[model samples]
Target chain A: MRILVLGAAGMVGRRLIDRLLAEGTIAGQAIDVIDAVDVIAAEIPATGRITIDVKASDVSDPDEITALIDKRPDIIFHLAAIVSGEAEADFEKGYRINQAGMSHLLEAIRAKGGNYRPRLVFTSSIAVFGAPFEEPIGDTFLMAPLTSYGTQKAICELLLNDYSRKGFVDGVGIRLPTIVVRPGKPNKAASSFFSGIIREPLAGQEAILPVADDVRHWVASPSAAIGFLMHAATMDTERLGARRCLTMPGLSVTIAEMIEALRMVAGDEVAGRIRREPDAVIEKIVAGWPRDFAADRALQAGFTADPDFASIIKAHIADEKQRVAQAGA
Target chain B: MRILVLGAAGMVGRRLIDRLLAEGTIAGQAIDVIDAVDVIAAEIPATGRITIDVKASDVSDPDEITALIDKRPDIIFHLAAIVSGEAEADFEKGYRINQAGMSHLLEAIRAKGGNYRPRLVFTSSIAVFGAPFEEPIGDTFLMAPLTSYGTQKAICELLLNDYSRKGFVDGVGIRLPTIVVRPGKPNKAASSFFSGIIREPLAGQEAILPVADDVRHWVASPSAAIGFLMHAATMDTERLGARRCLTMPGLSVTIAEMIEALRMVAGDEVAGRIRREPDAVIEKIVAGWPRDFAADRALQAGFTADPDFASIIKAHIADEKQRVAQAGA
Candidate 1:
């Protein structure tokens, strides 16, 4: 099976590509060609196992996506988006990239008729839901997004469902919880601190705790996100019916609990690196997010989450070690 | 206050225009100009009270709405749409009109800077909610529409909410229940039979009942829809916060209850003009619609519903008499 990965330069996208290359196959099919694309192509070296065509393609442009879809990749992984803070700050840029990008992609895929229905896995965010949520938000809660970015995701979810219903393409929209222990520097996402607090402290650096200790959030590991995407790509969607989007399973942990998990995994010295400097702006933004979810449908559909926060920390350390070893070699 | 009606030729639009002219003022503000536009221009006579400019404008086009927003109408009523059946048959046409129209309108309004924000009252549909619902679908139920038209409406609802949240526009989206006792012939809507059963029988003609008598539905009258729009236009949206959409209050009744009400209002002779020639296609389509709704939020916000089905029948009779009287004059 051939694959197309949009936003392949991003953390999750790069990891997914590395994982796919390592596996050499998906769902028992020998992977032949993988089109690794993004707004800016990254340094993806030659994997002698399969053909990796790395290129830069603007997903926001209709003609660009039309050309991409012309390649008829068997499975399309669409993970491109403008982060929440950037989208909320620059309205035009946000809609142009996040909203119009999805619209153009779906339209381009549909235009490729003749029953060219490829499995398209889209990464939607839990931001699609707003505040005053039901405890353990069920699979059927309304999407009253609090931010423009969330609204854009919610609209894309609707479009994806409709396009799938019309038989234009086989689609699955996974509403991923904020991925914790995100590698690299902090981005513009409001929830970036969820990762920074854990990632920075592990590197013997002081991390700013944006919210209070009592603040809780739904999160998953980077590996867990990749697992969700893989399952979404191969799962039987006949049971999904018209509702193609599902909230992926995630671990709900409070900031205090995360700190305790950090202490348990890497001792008090690393956990002590976190400073409790509450940011009112970040606190306000975090207040409108869902604390937990009853993602029963996703669990039933064979998606799994990290057992605990400690496992997440261990996994992140292992991933970091692997990256260092690769660089040393 | 200057007013602009996007779909001024349709049944509800025409009635809303007539009601606005009759009232002379909204929220204690006088209407100076009423720009009535639609895909096809209708003969809306000059009432000599307000300036009624009737013209044809395709809402799907961005440039046209940009020009419409240039007028700076204080209150804009956007009830334009591609009906469910047509949207289901032609996917491109549906998204182009319903989804693109709302997007373009919001963009145009946002583009008109200098703090120009107009009150945009949009007509959404109950079709936004799909089947297997809670006994009475609440305001916060997820939008997993079964049809393409519902998908488009649901998407538009998200856009409206986001734009409103961003302070680009002051928008209120009212999810109207099925309008019963409709004064015209049945159209392409799967729920058209709900009105046809009441309307054709009152017109001394037979109407087809395509579903079981026990099948329940949420419904309101023509005047109730107008009331919802007027209230939406004037209602203080400060309390709405980020969620600018609400399910309008409506009476829940089955076909048997409707027929009983008709018999009480117009006698068995008029009600007996009913045929039970069930159409399987329409039955399956209607099965996926919302049967009832709590609509507590809208009620709390001062929106009212018809007291009962008998009142709906009585109102239709009164409206018909008024129409005949106007024609005679």
Candidate 2:
């Protein structure tokens, strides 16, 4: 199996690469070649059996996208995107990179014009759903994104379905929830605090809680997110029918509940590192997001979420431990 | 009002143009210049008060699209598209014209750049909703179009909402139901039979009924469709918020009910011109279409439907009578 990972420098992309390396195969096929692409140069993992190539490339550039497609990777993991805050603030850059970039990539693949139908696993987001929910958003709720970033993702989902339907590509879009305990520094996404409050505290650092404790949101662990992408790559797409996009299963937890879980997992000292600092802007932005979802379709299709917030914290701790051990070695 | 109507040669576009000429204005502004564009040159209506220019143009061409935007029409009625059957048969042409054409027009408008936010009235379709519907599909149902034509329209709807939200264009997309009692010859559209059964019979000609009489579908009269477009041009869009696409209200009637309405309006002689011909291809296509809709949002926004199928038949007769009178004069 030849695999290509876009946004390979990002946290999920890096972790996914590591997981792929450990498994040495996807869907039981041995890995022959792997291409990792990003705007910034991606790290090429040292491997003896598999050929690994890492390169800096912008998806927005048609030539760059064509170059990636030339390798004809069996599975393409498209995870590159500007975060919510950045997309909202920089309109042109956002649309160019997110919307036009995806379109260009799809067109490039189509231009290849052969029996080559690559499996494209795209990462969509829960941001695709906006506010004023009547109930826990179901699998069939309309996509009326309140933000530019969400709109870009929703549009890409439409493209994915269309391309798949036309036989140009075998596409599966997984609308991932806000990834809990994202193992990285704070990013520009308004929902960044959702991860910061947990990740920062686990590392013995003070993290700001921008919103009220009562405010709830849907989330999944990083491992679960990676799992969704891997499953999407190998799943029986015939079951998907025409609707190629699925909202992945996620745990719905309030800020207070997350803090409680943290306290349970890493004791009172780690949980105490969170500071309640009101950020009206972030609060307003998060207010328009979906709090919960009934992602029955994804669940039926064999996608799973984190068992609970406590387990999510434990998983993050374990990952950090592994990273430390590797660095020491 | 300087008006531009793409696909101005089509039945609805021609009728809309006629309605505009009758009113002498749109949104309370006098009609100064009206440009009608289509793949084939549209017939220029001879009018003393309004300056009308009809021309042949392919919307898929960026230069042609830019040329249309240069006119700076206050309201743009974008109704051009290859019907379902044609789109399905010719894949590349469908995406090029339906999808790329719409995108080019939006980009052209955005490129104008200096406070040029034209009121763009886009004609979407009920095809945006696929089969296996649960009761009446609502305004908030997920768009999972089964056909390439539906996929194109659904994608355009997303683009319309995004562009409107970004303040690039003031766009309102109306998802029209199957137009019944159409005043023209049969076309390749799968739903063409819906109009054919009523239209050909009214003209004292035999019409084929391709599916079972119990098969239900959503429909609206030509006049009602025009009303939706005109209202969309002038309606206060603030009520729409981020979701700009609306499923227009229409009569939900079975084939039996439609025939009954025709008999009631035009007598048994006209209704008897129908022939039962089970076309498997058309039946399969029509089966996947929307049967009914709970268009609460469009209704609340003041878009109305024909009270019943009989009224729709009567409206078609009334329109025919007016056309006859105008020709005689």
Candidate 3:
């Protein structure tokens, strides 16, 4: 088996690549790391083919992806996307890169006809749903996205299901919760604070809480996100069939619980670095998002995540400790 | 009120234009018409400017729509789309026109971010929902589209809702049921037979029945579809708020009932013109579509349709009879 990781330079993309490389094989084959495509240059933990290009650079330029498919990667992880904040702010750039770029990749595979059926694992987000909450949203939720980014993701999910049913590819779209305890410099996603409240405090830096303590959200750690992708790639195809999209399992908690978890993991001194400053824009956008989701189907499919908020904090701490040890800092 | 009709050459589009012209006003204004864009060259029924362009043109080109919107029509009736059969046959064209074309319109509205909130009436379809019947599909049913056409429409619906809520455009997406007794040449839509069986028989011609008599479907008359577009344009924005997409009311009946209605209207001789031809492809596709839907929300919002299937047939016959008399054929 061989694998191709699109957007291999991004945070989740980088971690997913690490997981795949560390595993070394898929479906019993001695897997080869065929390619990694991204705008930013990615460091490979192991020797692998790489093609770094902006997703806009004529992805269908047959030369870009055809050679890799000629080698026929058994699995393709599509993790590329503009974050919600950027997409909502820059409309043209958002649709061009996120929507049109994905279409370009799908069209490339479709051009191959019956020659291949690679497991195409696409990382979608909960942002695909918006505003009115049905309370603990079920597996079967209509994608009424409020943001451009969510709309783009929902569009891609629809395309993935149709192409999969048409036998063009074996596709799976996993709608991940906002990955909490995200180990990185703070980013622009409004939900970034879901991770930052914990991550920054743990790293001995001050972090601002934009919403009220009562504000709730669904979350999964980075490890859980990687696990969801792996499960999506290898799951029983018959169960998914044409409707290839599923919301991944996650723990729902209030911001207060997140802070409590931070205090437990890194002590109150570390938690003291967090500050509260409410902004209406953030509150309004966050209000439209789903606070909790009942991912019963994913759980039934044997996909698991951190069962509680504390576990998520513990996972983040362990991950940060490992990074620190590697850096010798 | 000024109005712009995007697909003014279509059967429904032409009828809508006629209705609006006959009424002489919409929402209390003198009903000034602006332009009509369509694939074929045609005369506009309304005393407005006319613009004809292929539905398959590069609609993303700002120049294509800028001139039309220069007048800033108060209402935009976006009825343009490659029908189900054509879209399924030509996948790339479907995405380009149905998906990209819609984006162009939305982007245009977003670019002009002042008090220019035109009421955008987008024609959606029940095709957005596929199999596993829930009897009457609610407003919150998941968009698990079976075909590429349905997928395109669903994507557009999401974009319309998002853009509208963001105050870019005051949008309303109306999910039209298959129009029965379509008064025109036999089109290639899989569902065309729903109209063809009735219309062709009334015209004293043989009509092929691809599926069995027991095959059930949701349908609306051409007039009802027009009513839906008008109602969507003029409805209370506060009640609709962010959720601007709706499933319009339609009559659900099996092929046998349709034939019965035909027999009542034009006698057994005309009904007997319907030929039985079992087609598995049609059967397979139809199987995944909802046979019945209770659009209670639409009805509650004061939008209505023919109470019975017989009434639907009578309306079609009455309208076509006038058309035939006017033509003096």
Predicted structure with the largest lDDT when compared to the true one: 1
Provide TM-scores for the models: 0.98, 0.97, 0.88
Over A1-329, each residue of candidate 2 has an lDDT whose tens digit, in order, gives 89999999998999898889888989889998889889998876597788878999998999999999988889999999888878988888888998888888898889888899999999988778776674699988888888788888988998899889989999999999888888879987788899999899888899999899999989999999999999999999999988899999999999999999999988999999999999998888787788888989899999888899999999989999998998899
CA shift of B324, model 1, Å: 1.4
Chain A TM-score (model 3): 0.92
DockQ for each model: 0.91, 0.74, 0.68
> DockQ score for model 3, please?
0.68
- After TM-score superposition, the amount by which residue B287's alpha carbon in candidate 3 deviates from its true location, in angstroms, is 1.9
In the range B1-329, model 2's lDDT, one tens digit per residue, is 89999999998999899989999988888999889999999886598799889989999999999998998999999999998878888878998999999999999999999899999999998888776676789877888888888888988998898889989999999999888888878987678899999989998899999999999999999899999999999999999998999999999999999999899988989999999999998888777778888999999998988889999999888888988898899
Chain B TM-scores of the candidates: 0.97, 0.96, 0.93
Alpha carbon deviation, residue A106, candidate 3 (Å): 1.8
Interface RMSD of 2: 1.2
**Across residues B1-329, which tens digit of lDDT does each residue of candidate 1 receive?**
89999999999999999999999999898888999999999679779779999989999999999898899999999999979889999888998999899989998999898889999999999889887788799988999888898999999899999888888899999999888888876887677889999989899999999999998999999999999999999999998888888999999999999999999998989989999997898788777778889999999999999999999999998999998998999
Q: Which ten residues in a row are the worst by lDDT in model 3 chain B?
A: B49-58
lDDT of each: 0.91, 0.90, 0.81
Encode model 1's per-residue lDDT on A1-329: one tens digit a residue.
Answer: 88999999998999899889999989889999999999998668787879998989888889989988999999999999878888999999999999899999988888889989999999999989998799899998999888888998999899899899989999999999989999989877778899998999999899999899999999999999999999999999999988899999999999999999999999999999999888899899888789999999899888999999999999999999998999999
Which is the leading candidate under DockQ?
A: 1
Q: Name model 3 segments beyond 4 Å from true.
A: A44-72, A112-114, A185-188, A200-214, A256-283, B32-34, B43-63, B108-115, B200-214, B259-281
The top-ranked prediction according to TM-score is 1
Question: Which is the winner by lDDT between candidate 2 and candidate 3?
Answer: 2
